[model samples]
Target: MLVPKRNWLQQAGFLTGLYGQYLKVYLKTLVEYRADTLIALVAGIVAQGSTLLFLTVIFQKIPKLADWSFYELVFLFGLAATGKSINQAFFNAPFSLTGYIRRGQMDIMMIRPVGVLLQAIGSSQELNGVGQLVTGIAIMGFAGAHLDLQWTAGTLLYVVIALLSSAVIQFAVLLTISVLTFWVQEVRSVIYPVNWLYDFTRYPLEIFHPLLRGLLTYVIPYALGSFFPAAFLLRPESYGWAMWGVPAAAVITMSLAYCLWTFGIRRYSSVAG
Candidate 1:
């Protein structure tokens, strides 16, 4: 008996439906642990709030840092926060790959019919990210109003595209790191340094030395996800390349990450063996 192959649209719809089922399970778990979810949400808000407080203190002492005003810095932070939150909310389960591998869970996932990466992504959701998502939007609105940003239709569309690309970039970086667990088995220390690099995106890249600027722009490229997009919006004449660079970087990075993930999975061995 021959089974007909599904087209791209049908495949996409099937994947979407599968992911929706996973989300339902996650939601039920959240409902069962409402107190824990609430605590996590508050903790997330306070964690991000402390960073905002630090920025407020800095701006009070100086009119601008690296020629970026306080509101401009806030805009950059908000963009990065939103991107990180989206990644955490949807694609954060890879962080637990080490545990899955250690417990022989990866073996089970491999036997499943769905894509391994898709299963990893849909296995969990970080509800705390909802707090950061709300805070990021509020901060962006506040800073944009203060900066007197002209929110034309084109500007709005660009912002939406920029944020989604930014999220893809972050997810690519983290997923690439998590995929390393197939060989190394432990990556918490490595993950922390990469996360610390994200803090640099909250400020203007111009404040750093040329080497550091190059590191962010070409090496890690986290700044491209958050700082560049915000900078282009704030001063389009100054950072014109950012309009195209950010999306291009997202596509390139994600393609490379997915390739790495595929290679890792192919070589992965079962722990029981």
Candidate 2:
């Protein structure tokens, strides 16, 4: 047992070191476009903030949306923002994979010793994700003060779990969509629906039709990624099931995404050099 444990630890450390090198290279490349990167960062912050401003305008006439007050909605939006920021910062490289495939760059990835999927994901880095992260932190802080909930050790642990799960779900979803481009070769049209997912986080699941709510919760699983986590954190007594659902749904979606990506790559038929 101890021998197996030691081997597992060694493998974990090796993988961590490999990922660290990938990250280091990305950070270096990000700084290479300092000026343009700054402009993009500012634009991303304003774009995300403007969405929240619109939400505020709509909610002014309606005090509660399915029993969710303005601050509660803010908390949900913060969770969604933080989850998206995490995806943008870490997993968004996969978003470019489709372009690489169409441009025949993916052939080079297959010859590399590193995992091809991981290599494809690490090809491009976005420094602008940092701006989204900063805004996410600000939103969470505002939600904390306005929502006003008593925190405990267990609740803190759950909050961390929720954040992690939310990130995983969003990352998996994005990856799955990107991988689809291997077959479709044109996914720009679907991007609008992807953007619309953010709307789901603004209100509680209860606000949607029962069938649509079930579809989001059980099929696409977006509810688990943001709404359920926010619901649990902001109203633990009323939504305790989310404590289990958030992490469970994330794990399920990740496993499925990994399988889909693997299958998609195996089906890949790139041209010869």
Candidate 3:
């Protein structure tokens, strides 16, 4: 039996390699601005930690949200924070699409031989998100020690996969929302509410009204990225399906997001045209 070899180029592997190189460049540039980077890092820490503190304060009063104990909800918040930090550090440029479009810089990107979508996504990286990463991991550790997760080997592996998949799903959704700038010209206004939706994932989705829960699960799928993963980790007997759906949802959302981004770029009317 003869099997055809996989075509790496056909799968955009080369473009991803270029994206990695761009990330290296972005990191270098970020390091070059040491003072600003320090300030940004501190600001990111304060901003993300303040949100966590706020959640903790609220949970202190209520003790739980829809059956999720405080420590369990901390795990959920950490999962969402990890995804957000990873996206910010890796694909922040895609979320800044409006600025490029407004300045007519996209034509330069379009002229490059590489894939424009990859170029756009890897154009910038928020090195400051290191703080958020630290905060998230710290919170996860705290919850693990306090929440009685009783994690077996398999469960621990599932948690790692679920967190990674959640990050991929988050990045995909942000990319899809940001890519709309190609047609909309300016998307800053829309991005605010979108940010709020992403922020919502930081809490237990079960706390939402049934209608909103159904909408998130069936339509937005944000719950899959944060709430479901947490529910699986903290209450596996009840939310067992999330152990499977985390990767499944990530694959589906990321595949669709890439397709839309490619289609959008194909429709791009360069600034000159």
Candidate 4:
């Protein structure tokens, strides 16, 4: 019997449907553990709220930080927090890649017909991100009310695109680090220190030294996912490049991450082997 091959669109639809099924099961599990989910959600909010409180205290001493008003900083922090929440919600399973490799879980995923990356992503959902998502939206709304900005349809669309692209960039960077587990077997030592760099993006890039600015803009590029998007919205004349650059960076970094992921999979050897 000959089987017809599905086109890209059909393949994509299939993957999307499969992921939705994973989400449904995940939601069911969360519903069954309401108390634990609530605790996790509260913990996420408290952790993120503490950062906002710290910023509030700092702003009390000064009207502005690096020429950005407190509301402007809130917008930037909200943007970054939203992007991080999206990443944690949908793409955080790769954080356990080392454990998967050690426990021979990769073998099971490899034998499945689905893409390994998609399978890994669908294996778990970080429900705690729901709290961060809630906080980010609330913070953004609070800042938006205070900031003088035009809210045209184009601006709204651009904001959506920027936030989605920011999440893509974060996912790509984290996935790239996770892929390194194929070689190192334990990449957390590198992942944690690099992850801490995200904190720097919460503040205005102008406040940093040129070297650190360049590092964030080019080397790590977390600023593109956080600062640049908010900057573009807050000051289009000064940050016009971000309108396109953020999406471009997302595509470039994701391509590189997927290539690394593919390379890792090819070279992967099961623990039993």
Candidate 5:
């Protein structure tokens, strides 16, 4: 029974089909709220756009902040926004777990063949993140052209890894906070700090006081989501060590978040309606 029954392509093909069906259902619901989607998309665009504008205003007065030029800072902002948008698109929909817990809908997930976490995430998709995705790509491309990135194979590969690690780190933070719901029986309070953190990530981590820097880097490690990766991209030799730490930090923090989630699940008692 322990046979290598399917090759990697077969497994990937099956998963792709599953997600395709998932997206199909999501689109059916999405069309019913056409206006809401438009508003969300516009809000995402304005939000990221305003962040870039902030950088523009700052650079107009000062030559650079922490040795990062306007374009480089925008690249960091783009990294954070892209990673966040991708996470919103694929997972961590707002208020999903709260509804599940309070309504005892976890009972429904209990009998499903898929994992509860997967089912919860699969039930919601954020197409609004498209605005952020578009904005991020545009900024990154503009910054890349100005920065004159070498685009060597090794540098390109590192870029891919850094971006993926950034996404992983961001999602891990959100999930870790969301999983606190299993204890408190609510999510809003837990989710607030993470929401606040995005603003900090849109800028360089060094501008803050040392305590805040430590918090972002070590305690929470939001730095991995944008700053360090961008730092490595802009100044390779100086930030090489920091770049390598992103994936390692992602794995360690995500593993801890998963363990917390499983522990919370064990302790969970659903709220009665």
Candidate 6:
């Protein structure tokens, strides 16, 4: 009797290769409409820019929001925005699973050997998010420099983990809701409110009522996207505990999304007429 080969590393490599192939095709479409990418990038930058301007004006009138100063708030905004832009650039496209299900267009993918979720995302390139990326990094850097942060090696490591965790939280929440379309067949019902929810992270979570704060942190887990980590960095003694929750929130929400997706796939039946 011989043990079966368990090539998990090979499987991981195969998945990576699949993602690379999908991204290659997705990006090629950008050349067909180069101006569109610029337009997209500009649109994101303008949206984020205008919000920052509004916040700036508000802060000029009042010195602080809750325990956070203006620059600290900006740091949170930048972190959240950057994470969102990265998601928009690379991962959020997969939420279109709802659209494919409704259109009966997912049949092709069902027959394919690659992961459906990965293929869904790799199918499209949203390069306009590049604007958000640039704006986010610049703002984060400006805020980080001005804000008196503890710049330890451990702190820097936490920042990097928090950034990634934020992206995962955003995508996991969106995909979790969007995955419901497999059964509901209503895209607007699921995706439209994600826009509203996304705004919850653009400022310090402390400003919200305790109930709402809990909703954002545990139910939606939006604070993990930026606010929690920013707070941890700004006042480590106070919010350092929240930093660990950032990655934990990501893992929990994403795990829920995975379970939801598995259920959705099992219940998935062709809507083709």
* Backbone clashes under 3 angstroms, per model: 0, 0, 0, 0, 0, 1
lDDT measured at residue 142 in model 6 versus the true structure, 0 to 100: 89
What is the lDDT of every predicted structure here?
Answer: 0.85, 0.77, 0.77, 0.87, 0.76, 0.79
TM-score of each: 0.93, 0.86, 0.86, 0.95, 0.86, 0.90
Q: Highest TM-score among the candidates is held by which one?
A: 4
Over 4 Å off, model 6: 1-6, 27-32, 150-153
**In order, what is each prediction's RMSD in angstroms?**
2.0, 4.0, 4.3, 1.7, 3.4, 3.2
User: Which pairs clash in model 4?
Assistant: none
Q: Indicate whether candidate 1 or candidate 5 has the larger TM-score.
A: 1
Identify the candidate with maximal lDDT: 4
lDDT of 2 by residue, 1-273 (tens): 122334768877866787888899877766887786687678767967897797699788898877888888888887778777777777775668877887878888877655676776565556777677778768877888876776779877887788788778877777778778768867756754874675676568887789888877777677788888888888778888998988998898999999998999888899442
What does candidate 5's lDDT look like per residue over 1-273, in tens digits? Answer: 343466889866866676788888877766888887777778888997887777888889999998778888888888778777776776654447777877788877866654577677677677787667777777777788888689789877777787777777777787788887776656787687776776687678778899988888887787887788888888888888866687898888889977887887777654653
Error of 4 at 129 (Å): 1.3
Ranking by lDDT: 4, 1, 6, 3, 2, 5
TM-score of 6: 0.90
Task: Summarize candidate 4's per-residue lDDT along 1-273 as a digit string, tens digits.
Answer: 443478999988998999999999888877998997788778878987898899999999999998999999999999888888877877786687888889899999988778888988898578887778878878888899899988899988988888888878877887899888888858898887887788799889999999999998898889999999999999999999999999999999999999999998999878797
If the candidates were sorted by their TM-score against the true structure, best first, what order would they fall in? 4, 1, 6, 5, 2, 3
Q: Candidate 5 — worst ten consecutive residues by lDDT sum?
A: 86-95
Minimum summed lDDT over a 10-residue window in model 3 is located at: 1-10
Clash pairs, candidate 5, are none
**Which residue pairs show backbone clashes in model 3?**
none
Distance from true position, residue 17, model 1, in Å?
A: 2.1
**Candidate 2 minimal-lDDT segment of 10 residues:** 1-10
What RMSD value applies to candidate 1? 2.0
* Alpha carbon lDDT at 162, candidate 5: 75
